[model samples]
Each structure stands twice: as structure tokens, then as C-alpha cells.
Target: MKILLVLDNLSSSCGANVGIVYELARTWVERGHEVYCLTRKDRFHDIDQQKAGLLHMVWSFDVTEDDILNNVTKSDKWIHLSATGKAIFELTHPVFLQKMIDKKFCESSEIRNEYRKQIEKLFKERSFDAAVAVTEPFYIADALASAKVDTDKYVIMMDPYTNNPSTTDRTRKKKLAREQHVFESARKVFTLDFVGNDMNYLSEELLGKRVNFCVPKVKKCGAGRSDDGATVVDSEKIDFVYVGQLYEDIRNPELMLKIFTRLPDNYILHFYGGGCEQIVDKYKEILGDRLVIHGWVSSDESALAQQNAHILINMNNSIKNMLPSKLIEYINTGKPILNICQIQDCPSIPYIQKYPMAVNIMPMDNDNNIVTAMISDRDLETMAMEVQAFTENYQGKIVEHDVIENIYSDCISENVADMMLEEMQK
Candidate 1:
């Protein structure tokens, strides 16, 4: 089988999109199928001779000047647009502002025309069995749809399209209508959704479209490295560790900061991620030594830090459609999980509610001023004891054995491979 794998920014170890695409590519290639990567940029350029031989780069991506692997198969046309010129137009009107920030970088007519040309040419050259595209940029899916490519098209919605929180109200109906057309050619729609059951990645299925949500295989890891002696947390203090980027517009920590003030002196906060300085500075000033902020660290180090934490803190993002990848990592630790939910029916709540050691700080009606968890009361003293019981309990004492065991097993899902393979066989 020959397959097309599309990525906006290609890297082996970067974003969730990259992880899924690379994993699928490697899986298919190992199974003796040829997989071609179509993308805008290649951060690593570490593709070996053997793998590069089986892969092709499509469209207007300048992978690297050093790549003599000659991954290009049929992308001959290129159209570049200047964001500098568009910057002035962005402030002129609401319409211009929407255009400036809307969807992706590949919205230009020249680029779309070039895509149509290259797409047709590429299909003419190679007999591809299937094409898989993931969204965020959405243009790759857009391009595939626009080209009307006669292949088994598969769209993996890494994030929602019209259902996205930031999508303008004016464009909602048009975008929703386009959603059906964009994925009209898709043989099977797949989603890397952490939330379970009956939910389409796109909230409403226009024509009652059926979406195939699949959980990928999570490789087992050895117990995380512990007892470094050198520490971010005192080990004496009750540590609440959060490991991921805290975006200002998306996943703000302001509410969490407010909650932090109510905690006891022994509880300290440790955050690990980058560009978080702006968002953390005000709160960090108040907390002082209580808040420990580390620059972005490697995945291994982040996991190690989480392993040492008394409670792994999960923050709800502003967007309801997407689930944080770190939440999945936290659940696997079998550690006490403190999930903060600011939204109604947060995606994380469903996953963690069943775990004995997990507690959800759910949103409340601020009329009376209170924050409630899965436990009985939301008072300061009640919250303190609940935190203590979960964090200070004996090794494995707080964790429900049945729940933890089930979670561990559920991580390795054959559903993804089975569904995708079934599509390929068809």
C-alpha cells in the first residue's frame, strides 16, 4: 500500500500532530507500505536513507537545503505571500482582522491554485491507496478537498474546524456548511479525542456523518527516574506539579493562582514549560518561593518531575473541543491527579472522575463564592483535608487498584490500527 501523510510542521518529537503522523507513517512503512510526508517544514531533517527512499515531500515545503535525500516527487509550483503587507490591513476593519487571523497561512488563491495543480500532477504520477491529513492549519484538508483527489481521503481532526472557540460568529454557518464539503471525500473520519463516546470532533454532524474516534497505542514505559537528591520540590513540601505550556489566551492559570492562596504553607507549586514568564510573573511575585517556574525541559525530564510530584495538576484550556496531551501522561503515572475545570463538562473530568486518587475542581456559581471538587464540601478546611488525604496517603493506598489497573491497560488501544487498517484493506 502507498499512503500520503500530511503535516503542517513536520518533526518526529514535537507536537501531538507530529507524534500521530510519524507513528502512523512508521507503522505503515514497517508493514511494507510506502508512506510519503507532505508538509511545510521539517525541523529534524533526520530522515535516514532507507526511510527517505520510501517517502516523498509534496507542495511548497522547503524541507532543508541540506536534504539531498530528494524527497520531492511532484510538487513543482510555489506561491509565497507577504505577512508584512497584510499587517497594515489587519487593523483597517473587522473583516480584515478576521481575514488576517483566520484559519491558516495557506489561504491565498495562488497557493490554492498551485495546490490544485500539484495535487492533480502528483496523483497522475503515483498510485496512492490513501491520503491522511490532520487539522490545525486546516489547509491541507482544504487543499485535499479542493483538489477533488480521487483517492481514499482520511481526515484526522486534531482540533475542531467550525466548532473552534476562536472562529468568528459571522462565519459559523458558512464554516459549518463547508465542514461537510471539506470532508465529503473522506472514506473515514478519525479523531485523536480523549473524550469518549458519541461525540464528533466537529460538534454537529451536518449530514449525520459518522466519525471514527480511535485511541492509539501507548508504549509501556519503565517507572520514571526518582530520587535525584537535587530537587525542584523540597520533597518535604506537598508538591503540585504542572508540566506544559500555560497560554494566556487558552489555558490561563489566574484561577488556579487564586485557589493557590487558599492552600496551606507546606503546599508549593512547580510549573515546567516555556514563554510562561508573562503569565506567571504577577502570581509568582505574590507566591515568591512558593512558585517554582522552570524553562521548557525535555519530555523525559518533565515525566521525571511529574513522577516526583505529590499531585499532578491539570488545567482546563479555554477550548472545550481539545484535550491536553499532558493529562494523558498524568493519568498513566497512577499519581494523585488534581484536575482544575473552568468549563462546563470539561474533557478531563470524564477521564479522571473514576480514579480514586483523582479530584476535579469543578466550576461553581460565583454568587456565593465557592469552588467544589468531587468530594463533599468546598470550604478551605474541607479542601485542605481532601488534598491531604489524596497526597499524603500511603504508596498506592489512595489509588483504587481496579481503576488504576484498568487505566493502565486502556492506554494501549488497538482500535486505531484496526480501524485504519480496515480502511486501507477496503
Candidate 2:
């Protein structure tokens, strides 16, 4: 069997989507199937280099950052008339610029034509048995749909539809129409989380079939090790680690700041990913050295940090429908988790509850009101105590590598690959 995966970016390490794509390609290659990946030329080269053997072909377009930027500005002009459009431009103009830039580039007719021509060339080289289009930027899938590829095409929707703050009603309608077109054109649609169930209704309305659900899995990057060659459990400070971006709206760290500042001196909060500069700057005086910011580290370094930390922290405030990919990595560490999720029915709640060492705290004041009625100091102290107790309970217990592997294996890419193969056969 031959498979083609279309994506925007494929980083060398530390992304759940990239990990899934690599694992799927790996699984197919191990099974003697041919796998080809097509992404933008500007994507991290290390990813393609690292998986050279597994991927039969790693094709990239001549699209550059400047090209994407220029296209984004052109696209922005189309939406400039509306208040939402102006707000979207201002909010994401420079800081969160990738979202709009990628969207515009993907939706460009000229770009799609170029992609279609290249895809046609590839199709001429070898007949692809199936193609998986990850829905984001939504351009590759749209291009594939327009090209009328004969193979079994599958669309994987990783995120639910949220009304874009910067989009006009007309733009929103067009986006939805394009998504519906992609869904209607696919052999089958798949989602990484149960939140896609809500999209099932839309799929049924458009294509008379519901979307399928699959668990998003992470690759077993080896456990993180300390420089001094000692286990994290033996460390003097009780490390509470958080990895990934700290978007102000979605996954805010303000409440965590409130809790961390009040914690005992022995307890330190370490941030491993980017996008928390504002929070770090605001609390720099009070946090002092207790808050350690490691900016962005390699995948190995992140795994090592997770392995060393006394507790893994997840902050899911108000963001619904998507599961945090970092949770899989945290679980792999076999350390106690401190999940502060305000959403009552967050999909991660059940998983956290399943793990004995994990503590899920849904603060009473979780509404959009961040200023008023925040997580009280009393509750913060109580939660800190609970976290300490949870950590102490698993201090000496060694969770074998195999145990962690088994937990992740259930959702491994092999399972998803096999499922896709079965769907293709049908």
C-alpha cells in the first residue's frame, strides 16, 4: 500500500501532530508499505532528514515565509471591512501570525494550482492507495479535493470550529462551506478527540455519515534525565512542570501563578515551552527564582524535564473540544499530574481520574472572569498540599518503562494506521 500525508509543518521533535504523522509513516514502512509526505518547503528540515528511510518521498513546495506573509496581507484586505476582521488582524497581526498566514497560503488558488500540479506529477510517478489530509490551514485538503484524486481520501479534523474573532459572517460562511465540501468529498473523516462528535452532526448533514474518533498518541521519546545523573525524585525542590504555550485566552497561567506564588519555597514551577513571556514578566518580582523559564527546549530535553519533575501540570481553562497532546507525554513520565481544568465536561477529566496519582482541580470560579473570583488562596494551599501528598505517595514506586509503553500503545499510530488501511480496503 502507498500513502500520502499532507501537512503544513513537520518539526523535528515535540509536536503531537508531527509525532502522529511520523509514527504512522513508521508503522507503514515497517509493514513494507510505501509512504510519502508532502509539506511546505519552509518546514523544519530535520523532520524529513530524521525519517528519510521510513518516508519513501518527502516532497516540499517552493512556498516561502515571504510568500505566506504577502498572501496573508492580501487576504487580510478582504476582511478589513468588518470589525471582526480588523480585530483579528490587530490581535494576530504579529504575535499569533501563523494562523492567518497559513490559512491564506492554503486557500490561495495559485498556491493550490501549484500543489495540484506537483501532486499530479507524484500521482503519475506512482498510484497512491490512500491519502490523509490533516485539516488545519485546510488548503492541502481543499487542493486535493479540487484535484479530484481517485484514491481514498481521508480528512482528519484536529480542532473544532470556533468562531474566529476576526472573521465576518460572509468569511465564516465561506470557511464552513469549504470545510463541509472537504468533509463531503472524503471517503471517511476522522477526529483525534471525542469533541469531533459535535462535528458528526455536520458531517451527517453534509455526507450522511458521522465522523470516526481516534485517540491521539505520542511517540515514546526516552525519559528525560538530569545533568547530575540523579532521579528527579531525589531533587531538593519539588518541581511542578508545565510544557506548551500559555495562550492568554485558551490555556492561561494566571491562576497557576496565583497558586505557585503561594506555594512553599521548596515547591518550584518550571515552564518549558514558549508564549508565557507576559506572565513571567508580570510575576518576575514575586516569582523571583521559583519560576524557572527554559523558553523552548528540544524534545529530549522536554522529556527529561518531565521525567525529573515531581509533578506534571496541565492548565485547560475554558478551551473545549480538544485534548492536550502534552498529557500523553506527562502520562509517559509516570509522575503525579496536577491538571487545573475549569471545563466541567473536559474530555481529559476522565483520563486524569483514571490515573490514581493524578489530581484534577476544577476551580469554582472558572468563567471568563479571570480578575474577580479567582482560585482562592485557601483553595490554592489545599491543592498544593494535595499535590505534595500525591507526589509523596509515589516517591519510591518505579513505574516500569514497559508499563508506560503499554499505556501509550493503546493509542499508538500503528492502531490508527491499521484502521486507515481497513477503511481504504472498504
Q: Write down the TM-score of every candidate.
A: 0.74, 0.81
lDDT per residue for candidate 1 within 137-179, as digits (tens), equals 5666777777766888877776777676666878667676666
Cα lDDT of model 2 by residue, 1-426, tens digit: 878887755657525666666766687787888888877654333344766556887787776553545455445354244667756665766733654544453455555666667777777777888887775556667777766567888776666643333346657777777777777777776766554655533644654433554554534434231224224464477777899877766676776777776667877888888664666678767988898888878877887787777778987746456677788666656667888775677768766665556777665555634441456777777766766676677643445545555655655567777776666677
TM-score of 1: 0.74
Off by over 4 Å in 1: 42-60, 63-118, 193-209, 214-217, 221-235, 275-277, 366-385, 394-405, 408-414
> RMSD in angstroms, candidate 2?
5.6
Model 1 steric clash pairs: none
lDDT for model 1, on a 0 to 1 scale?
A: 0.60
